[model samples]
Target: MTAGDELSDATAEYITANDIEHVQIVGGTGAVSADVASALTTLGVDTVARVEGDSAAAVSVALAGLANDGCGDDLGLVSSDRVALVRGNPDGVVAAAVLASSLAGGYLVTPLVVGDTLPAWVRGCLAATPRNIGADRLNLGVVAVGGTAAVSEATMEAAPDAASSTDALTVRIGAATDTSRDGAINADDPVRPDTATAGTATAISATASPATGPVLSLCFSDAVTATDNVDRVRDVVEVNGIAAVVVNAAGNAGSVCDQSRIDVTLGQTLSAGDVISVDGSSIKLGTSADQRSFGSATATVTAPARDRVRPTISIVGIAGAATARSTFEIAFGDNVALAGTALLANDEVRIVGGPGGTSPAPAVSVAHEPGASAAVATVSRPLRPGDRLIVDPGAVEDGSGNQSAGTSGSAIRAQASPRINQVLMSDLKHTAHATWTVPTGSVAGVGGTGAGITIRAKGDGDAAGAAGNGWSMVFDRASTYSADKPLDIGVSVDPKGKRVTVRFNNGPATATLGDLIAALNGDDKFAALFSAGSPAALWRLPTMRPVLCWAWSRLATWLRASATPVAPSSPSR
Candidate 1:
């Protein structure tokens, strides 16, 4: 008999007085309350049974057995190993059962959702027959049962050796969505199959741990219609005339946006809304001033989905050129993904209208700067004043798969600088000399007349190469000097290569100056060298160094004084 309330002593007594032969409980949790079970026993009604869950519903459909077991077309009558449900109102539950049974294949496996509005969908399904759903609509249904490791009776052993009666059953349920599910299923909800299993018994669960509720199941009739609702299907088991419902709790709930989600990688620890940039295959946070950013997301994600956006380019400044080497920077609109093959060369940049009748286009190398939404490109050739650069289409791409378009820019004038290619040393006619090759090219000296150059020789220790008097020598031709020209340094110009060579002569010494020569050649401090190119480039000799030139002068003096040794070793006599 169907009853909404619990059966008590009064109900039992009434049943006994009527001389009822047996009792069968249907619906309403699928099991009679313990009080009612005891009451019926006291009245001597031994034949008591319950049909709940899918089994109760299946009884009505299977009453007329099919000529063939697999011939039934309805989700209710079809043979399925498992069924998932979305619990709702009475009508919704009934409709869910009918829908599951009607659509269930040999095995109906689908994630279903039930909520206040699911009943209407069910009604629609009932109104329409012979309509087939796409395979994508229904998930393969699975029945998972879990609870405290403890069984209600000692008759059954625990499934695991370590299982204790106190152990709680926590089966991890996986969801199809990436977001976490929370507050969907409530406590003590029933979980059940939509139809009976092969054995004519429906699997069901009735107790949901109040602490951890079940994740809300998803139900959808079409792509446009879907819901994640608070509905539960009990995990039911009928054995020994006892209809048992296993408890299931834990429902996941969240609103899924139409856009996709992504993981984010940041240069620094992430904060909410921090900008993202591409650095090869990975992503990192961009600077606040960096306007170029793919998008923003929670710091937790290593990479997140964003609109496919292109990067914008801006010129920071131009450098190099005077020395035949140039460098420039291009700022991006935002930080981007630059991993894999994402970051590539901007082949569109070309140089035009530069001096020397050569392509002003700089041979450049590209690199992404960390924490900045900019890229640095270094050029191999010098830039002329009139040179202009044109960036054709497809110059660069951002991490988010955005490519830069064509643009144009003018090269700014830069000062010229002298570069020392290599140094040369020699001993010609007993005169130790050093020569420095400075290529000035089109770079003029200060005031545009000529490159002003200076060469000073200190005695390694003193201010000049000489010990007693002319310790330092100024090689500038413009400087005044005695006719003797005691200083042995000279500066000359090479007009052909547009080069300057400085010569330092230790003076004609008949005696060996090997030690001093070695010092002069080895010690960069042997001389102080300086130069000012037209525009002005700062450079120094790599091997030039400070040394004990004063000591060398002393040694030279001693060498000259001993040159007249009367009779060397006239005798250890």
Candidate 2:
């Protein structure tokens, strides 16, 4: 029942030391089991049997055969299972090993008809230190199990309901002396409540071993059952003739060993098959204990290393362009060095948005700012209103070599005044009597005025060539309409109190074109236009091209000569 090597060696030593004559090894098929058999025979001791099995049932059959023979007291049964046994006998002994293979099969069923002798053999291994002392030298607590009054000194007490028929029960015991070790309970150890109590039959199917006290829990074979008009209950179960209440209505059946197999207070990790000995009332592993340890103990496993956090980029400050160049200040969440020799070449720092107002934005230059925490990016072009600049992160790494976070850049923008563009002039066609042009000062909508041009016709009191010189009308900024008829132009004062105009026409001798142009300019109407070559005559020059132009119909052309109108105003949407 003990471990492989220790079982064989200890038994042999005890036999030789005590001058034993006869021996029997039962129920084992391991190398150590065979060695025990061989060593006994070599020592001139008679070997009775060597039991072997492929399963628990087969082993039970083998044990039954040997128990029937009833040959020796010092018997040996060997197996690789966790069972351990060490019994002392002055005359003879029977030792056996229930190896690892058959131990899991649970119960070792014996001859049903046989009495105590067969069941005792079925009890199999008992924990102890093998010695040549008399059987009385080591006292074992009195224990018993099922069937009519099988346990000695059991008393029956009143239960709510006692079965009309005979009931079965299981029982257990502990050391009589406080100094003695508590008896070890094995799995399938037969137990029954006191027969004298009124209750149903019950059995114990668990192993219970306490670490250091006389305390032991005895469980019932089944739940408390009711019979007749009452509930059956066992009151007290006597061990060694002392009445005690050890019966539990609810049974806890399973392996009941200390959570820690061997006490670890001595700094020794316990394993199965370790040779154990009792030294001064304490049990411990032997020097030659088998090194082939048992089950795996519960423990925790941890990782060795962890990774660092990645760095991130953020915008420190953004300022409007004071000069032609726009600048942005940027910083990183972590201290980082440029990836390459220069900031622009560093793949880590990417200029996500090009220069603010530069048409084909050029590459931006970066300079480390006064504070080591941030840097400045200078764009080559002047920033325009509503311009956005972006900088993204790439291969930048922190001091610990952790790469910067790959994400969108912190954006920045510069400011400027609002402006508008002039409408294109080629969109219009000319008529036979007059030509039109859009002036440079005009803007879209109500923002800018039509200016910088004058309109004059040849029929404007020029007696020398009155009939041949047709009226030449020069347009200012009035390019926002599409029509076959003449576009309307009126006068209005701007926020700055300046008069703006969009229309002009030929005039008669009493009010010549030169005189009309001078009058409009004096009123802060359209841009001033007087011929430098001849102040007396208002003329169009080749250099004075229109900014935006549109043609008027022939019918509308005659109306301008009769009207002495105010300055022209910007067209409506």
Candidate 3:
């Protein structure tokens, strides 16, 4: 009897007393030994014997003895499920009991067996501790019966009425209006009350007259449920401007009449602010009044018609240029100049007959000389029909070449002069002999006794002189020539002497003396001598002068004498 045996005995006793369904002995030395197994068999308990370590033969002999009571099969025996333990040492019995029980319902009890060698039942018990026993109940079908005693005590303390019976109070909402009662006055149809306080009401049976007239009749039962001491009854009635008084209850006064009864008559139609009340309590029918006017009207306005006139036109000057010719051209109608023929100085000539009433003025051109009565040469070309022309009176030119005005007789004169002697000598000898002087010099073929012989002289020789040879003899002596050369000669006599000049062989020669002077004064050979100065000399001609001077001098003098001047006519007043 060691502690291990004691533990095993205690476990077996507890299991047998509680009738546990399974008992497992795990890890013990020896088998249940023959005696322990016999004991369990005698007690009529089924046992499973298991062997461990090198004691299987001995365990088998004990199991055989224990088998005599039919416990070998009924009380089962076996080696370890471990092959090594079963083969090497199988002497010990580690036993477990499997009683009748539901696997789904029962718990497992596994006992610890202290030994190095274990039987199969002990090893199976060790394995079955985790496998067969449930960690928690598989089905929680049973109601839990667990609770602490103090929890019941606490519940009893919290609810003192738990042992008592309950009763209820019944309150009906809006129930008063649902029923009628005797001696209850009807003030009006009752509106639903907002809250359930002790007592506030308007009696539902009341009636008041319609609001159309000035007098309203309110009727109510004499009895009311109001608890206030003053007991004022208000009739919210719409009425006209009539005063109403309370009538006697039940329509009876005294034998004749009652002082509590009153009548009403309306003065005007009812409006806002009319009310009826028994005391301080009153009904406000309405607050605001509708407004109206006796006579009202509206008028619509319309705009007036527009009267627009087109622009007009005029001419600025009569016999002068227009102020604005360009402006007038665009504003005028076709053939506008003919239409504006009456346009005078400063006359406003309005153009007419166009699409709109507007028309343009005709452009006019006028000609006038400034400040002169002479017929003004209106130098402007005449305008063709319908042509616009402008004439500026201020812009005028005179025949005297003045732009503004000139003297009436003002005329241009030719200032050149012409004379025969002024003609060049060479021109007279060659081209214009009638108007010019002949060359005064020797002729080429004539023979000469003096400087050269003159083939032609101005005059014959003069009278004789004192020495018995006449003056003519000396003149002849000077003028005599032999035929060695020919010459051309000219003679001019003055108070100083006579000069006889000869032209010979294209060279000029001169001889001067008294006899040649007298001969030149006789005027037989030359025509006449005109004196240019006081000495009275004749002009000579040069043989080689240019020809143009002779022709121009004669033509100039003839033209000057034959020219005529024309006078201009006066302007009209």
Query: Which 10-residue window of candidate 1 scores lowest in summed lDDT?
Result: 564-573
Per-residue CA lDDT of model 2 for 10-54, tens digit only, reads 666777788877665545665246665666678667544666665
Which candidate, 1 or 2, would have the higher TM-score against the true structure? 1
- Tell me the lDDT of candidate 1: 0.31
Assess every candidate by TM-score. 0.20, 0.17, 0.11
Which one wins by lDDT: 2 or 3?
2
| Model 1 Cα lDDT, one tens digit per residue, 417-529 | 54432232221111111122211111111011222221222122232211212222212222342323222334444323322333434222221112122223333434232
**Candidate 2 deviant stretches above 4 angstroms:** 1-305, 316-325, 334-356, 368-373, 382-393, 399-401, 406-573
The predicted structure with the larger TM-score, 2 or 3, is 2
Kindly provide the TM-score of model 1 when superposed on the true structure, using C-alpha atoms: 0.20
Error of 2 at 18 (Å): 54
- RMSD from true fold, candidate 3: 72.9
| Model 3 alpha-carbon drift over 4 Å, by segment | 1-378, 382-437, 440-518, 521-573
